[model samples]
Target: MRLARTLRFDQSDENVFERAAQPDEWAVSGAFEFSNWSEDDLSGKRRQAFANGWLGLESFGRATFVATAKIEEQEYRALVERLAAHFVEAWGAPDLETARPVAEKELAFMAGLCDEHEPNTLLIVERSLVTSGVSESFRAIAPQEATLDLVAVHVTSDD
Candidate 1:
């Protein structure tokens, strides 16, 4: 889902880097592509950002880090519409080709996924972000405002 969010950096602390790398409140509210990968990467998306930490699933051999930006709400609907079109034009969501008004359909698809994975928004971060040396590289120049397009699939208990 596309929602407005802000991740302010508190550079005052000695552990600012540590704080930036860790997931914030918005991370729990929705899944985010923290990386710069295309939304199509979501079909194979398996990693997510959470309040406590991250989650990953290796489904059908598709997974990657795709960071998400927190954006303003005014542009949210347009972005979703653009995303729907992006999938159809760039990624080729064949089924969406037939779904008149692709944006609404995309919204439903995302909403359904969100329903199943609420209270834990996904985040796409490179292994380097959460892994060793995270403190030095994860720092943000300023607070961000963007939407999160979550595509990571949560594995079942059996899986």
Candidate 2:
């Protein structure tokens, strides 16, 4: 199976998100967090997050970029448990048993988003408040063949 993991090119996420997700943590669209929000509620970092954040499963934080990655079944199961627990604590789910299916569906949707892309392909989600509720759209950036090294470092010495 495949899912998205947070990627950090810089420290901007730390500045923009309430909590910045650590690089490589699992991520989902996480629009669920704003289920009850109104236009008046969209301001500041919350606005930034609503515009373009991927929710990290581990930290429950936000990330601006996420890359597709392979996931083992065991790890997927573990994520389900963690997310279900979160639903209980964060959303007041009746119990773990009731939250389990909801968590599974959330993860499954994330996995489906990765199904058509290759590993390391970056995915972005843009969300906007529609009349009924929030609407999400995804864009994918596939990795390209590099003609030269994408990064380089210079060393200086004084003698």
Candidate 3:
């Protein structure tokens, strides 16, 4: 199945996020984290995260970008289990049994987001507070040719 994983082009995320997700960690939209929050609740790094960060499933950290990638069934199930536990611990869900379905739905939505995008296409999420709740829109950045090769392979001598 296709899913999204954290992607980092530079170290700027370290300064922008409270905790920056390591590259390649699984990611989700994470809008649920702000379900009970308001404008006042977001400040500084927290606000940055709400603005344009993808939630890393493993670290509970934030990433500026995520790339569509493939995931196996076993890894997916483990992610479900981890997120279910997080719901219980972080959101006060009754238990894993109750949280499991909700966690699955979140991951399923994330997977669906990746369905149309090709593998390695980077995605960014922009979130805002709507009257009823949070609103999110996604933007996709297509991959480019390996430009790094020019710097690595073609060095010119000084004139």
Candidate 4:
């Protein structure tokens, strides 16, 4: 029998999120930086993406490195579109051949840590981009309380 990972959230602490960000093995290439609260950014908006309570993927540049946090599917794709737009303006269309799978692998890594899949869950990627590239609407949601969003983040860098 296939046992689904428990996808419960700790109302007060980020430990649950921290554990969720990690899997037995990582699929993406690069060194994984696992921390209680690792720092990360999306474009110009910096946040505690790696902390026990955060969500989404912080992809810095193309094939550079990737960090992750949990996110909703809709929110996730929206961020990717933002990145795609950024890449299109800068270089003219993104080379998905290199982008899509990388994001998927990281997404799956986090998913595996969950007890069960939630419909609202997402696979968002926050590439290191200029804040302007991201729509103001995305930033409108201030005060990201951990309880409201069951997510976590992890950073990665090559030695």
Best by lDDT: 2
Rank order (by lDDT, best first): 2, 3, 1, 4
Per-candidate clashes, comma-separated: 18, 0, 0, 16
TM-score per candidate, chains pooled: 0.26, 0.92, 0.91, 0.25
Query: Which regions in candidate 1 have their CA more than 4 angstroms from the true location?
Result: 1-75, 91-100, 121-159
- Model 2 score (lDDT): 0.94
lDDT, each prediction: 0.33, 0.94, 0.93, 0.31
Pick by TM-score: 2 or 4, better one: 2
Q: What is the per-residue lDDT of model 4 for residues 76-102, given as tens digits with 9 covering 90 to 100?
A: 565445434434453344675455454
Which residue ranges in model 2 land beyond 4 Å of their true spot? 147-159
Clash count (model 4, backbone only):
16
Best by TM-score: 2
What alpha-carbon RMSD in Å does predicted model 2 have with respect to the real structure? 2.5
CA lDDT of 51 in candidate 3? 93
Model 2 lDDT, residue 42, Cα: 95
Q: For residues 1-159, what per-residue lDDT tens digits would candidate 1 score against the true structure? A: 432122333432113222232222222121222334333332311222221222211110111221233435555455455555544664456755443365555444434434443232443323323433232112112224454545456778999
